[model samples]
Target chain A: MNIRQKVSLLLILLSIMLALLPLTANRSFSEKPSKLLAEVLGADVSVTVDEVAEFIVREDPDVRLIDLRPADVFIKEAIPGAVNVPYSEFIRSDPDTWISNREVRTIFYSTGNSEADYALVYARGMGYNNCYIMAGGITEWVRTVLDTKFSGGRITARENALFETRRRAGEMYTEYSSLPDSLKAKFLESKKFSAKKLDGGCE
Target chain B: MKFLRQYPFVLIVFLLMVVLVLFRSFGGNNFRYDAARWAESSVKGSNLLTVDQLSAMTGAVLVLNLGDEADLPGQLRPKTVIMRPESITGKENLRLIRKHRGPVILFSDDASTSARVWMILSEMGMRDVYILRDPGAVAE
Candidate 1:
């Protein structure tokens, strides 16, 4: 066989092999298993409920809280400023659509920790290193941040600051959660529209 | 020989592609199941098995305890292997999991840990793997 003929045959063989492989063209983990595991199990992968409260009070633009609960439950109540990305939808759909900005820190929280932890692993496995979990989910938030009370005779400056943040955050949560369904729907719609505008998308 | 001499660049590129394909084919790091499939099973709650359900099963079940020894129940002690969540992807651990014939169950005191470990194992293409759910735990 001619050299040209051999090269052509090799090219055709490689193409055929590539075509036959069960390639997951979308939604497969890109990170090495060990590395992703290490990151997920690391100490820095979770933030305390107090820290999330502080974020809410300060209106931190760099942080995005994701509520991984059912849509109806989210509409009833959620952490102030948290956007609902139901766990099932988050897993089924392309995560890039929900967690588009790599610069922002995305924190996942469910009613408990299971869904959030799953999301953290899935996102990090897909090469989104900016993901984290709110340690002890919304249940913990309700326990620590929402029901916070002062029993001490005298409060230190640091204690005062912490309580202040929690109080403000709790107030915001109550106000948002207590809104009527129609108003809540409008608020969510407005937030969605603003988010689209920020993304440079048209109506 | 003539082709190598005449078209070194093309031959080199072809060789590089061949190496990549081989590496990917043999690489243990790649995910076996797609995200959609994992999501389907997860949403359906088919990947979770409670302790009561596990007790009823009459098969050779391999339980992987990803938490403290004290956390594991008394009945599951015989066939259980205590493993750290982070080491699950290690060469030896992967081999042990792959070699096991029966269904493999992952348990942890923290439900999140089990959930995360289950997804990782599922993505690696391991079948018949399940998370041992606590009866008291609330479903998300």
Candidate 2:
């Protein structure tokens, strides 16, 4: 056979192999993986900070929020439920200190958007499909809630902040108004701080 | 010109594969050794402790290799905080270590932390110690 014919045949074979690759092993069932992965994992592959903050607002977000942040930032203002799961130790049998059964949605986040995203992708590659990335992460949440700017969009940032302030002024209202009265008191008292959901999607 | 200089592409590919295999093996060796040692134990003269047996050694060992978030029963309590070495460091660990008294099983997942809290705790006579120093498993 001519060299061109042989190379063309080889290319065709390679194309066929590549086409079947995903179907065989790479086939992933991540629900809306791109949008969700994109939402959590930014261009460089880290989850955003705002996503982490929203987690603090989750109804019962307590899936061990691991702060895969650098040591320096971790010291400054590590969120209440966050335990630093520094990325340096990739092979640490128990990567994170809080190993409460992977059953508990172990949502991961970081100070930067890309760091957490890479970890999430790596974890997903390692067969950990139950993990998630926090939306916007702590940075966004702090900016929206703490700094008071275009937050929920329904109300002005100042108005939203004022509402939280007024509510807290009356009494630390942790549990929402929709919750039972007894639970409201419990939440208000347990300002210990916690939330659930990985800002990212399940891989 | 580049192809000529970088000739023997197949050889290069084969070498890459070999390097990758070695790297992967090196990565998991430490944990594999620990698992092996544990498996070797519980075998007085003949019987060996399977992984199941070894894990069972850590009584009430809750394996979190499953779902996302779980709700523990109001009464459930974990006595031991088995953790990898690189979990935390410095002042952060100082605050955390003092909080949990249950023996913190430090599985040498990687290099030890420079956390003085861990050092102080080690010196303070807090024992329930099991340090598996496996050089092969460089969780780096």
Q: Model 1, range A1-203, lDDT digits (tens) per residue? A: 46787678668757877787766645778888888778888889999999999999889999999999999999999887888889998887778887878999999999988889888988998889999999999899999988979996998999999999899999999999999989888778776512333346678
Error of 2 at B37 (Å): 24
lDDT digits (tens) for residues B1-140 of candidate 2: 34323334433544565566445333321111121122121112122112333333543332211112222222222532333332332345434554554434333222122111122223222333233223123222
Task: Report the number of the highest-DockQ candidate.
Answer: 1
Model 2 reaches what TM-score against the true structure?
Answer: 0.32
Q: Assess candidate 1 and give its TM-score to the true structure.
A: 0.84
Would candidate 1 be rated incorrect, acceptable, medium or high by CAPRI criteria? Answer: acceptable
Best by lDDT: 1
**Tens-digit lDDT string for candidate 2 (A83-117):** 66665532233333344356666766665343454
Error of 1 at A170 (Å): 0.9
| Candidate 2: residue A63 lDDT (0-100) | 58
State each model's TM-score restricted to chain B. Answer: 0.75, 0.28
